[model samples]
Target: MANHKSAIKKIRSDERKRLRNRYQHKTARTHIKKLLTTKDKEEAQLLLKVVHGMIDKLTKKNIIHKNNAARKKSRLAKYVNKLVATA
Candidate 1:
């Protein structure tokens, strides 16, 4: 539907970016779920670090809101701490 060549190129580029963002978001969510289900304190701690990095990257890329990232990281940290406390 785009009549101009530039508009067509923009649409193509936007599609690619959208796919990339979707993939990253899905991957992050998968990791978060894995972390949430982990019973081992050591493993959970490792996953917490990795998940935090992924969340920070998403925030920096503007794929997710900063507050959303912060909330995720906070909850994850609390969960990991609770695991440690129990152990």
Candidate 2:
């Protein structure tokens, strides 16, 4: 239990931020899953643009690390390229 008013406020603020981060992270994961499952190269390419933008926003906000975002984009691009290669 926080004894100081400032500490209490800090805890509340932290909780709100935590929840917001979780939601954004989960949403990003969902989009990533969708991208990974998509078999059509054209659709995946379009989705890649949207997902990349989302990842950039998350990285800028400090919700996700820059390296993590870069890794995801790399892997997704690889997958999208493979789809075209296979067809």
Best by TM-score: 1
Cα-based lDDT at residue 1, candidate 2:
98
Model 1 residue 9 lDDT?
Answer: 100
User: Candidate 2 on 1-87: residue-level lDDT in tens?
Assistant: 999999999999999999999998899899999999998888899999989998998999999889999999898888988896335
37 Cα displacement, candidate 2 (Å): 0.5
lDDT of each residue in 7-87, candidate 1, tens digit only: 999999999999999999999999999999998899999999999999999999999999999999999999998885335
Per-candidate TM-scores read 0.95, 0.90
What is residue 82's positional error in candidate 1, in angstroms? 0.2
* lDDT at 17, model 2: 93
Clashes of 2: 0
Q: State in Å the error of residue 52, model 1.
A: 0.4
Q: Give all candidates' CA lDDT scores.
A: 0.95, 0.91
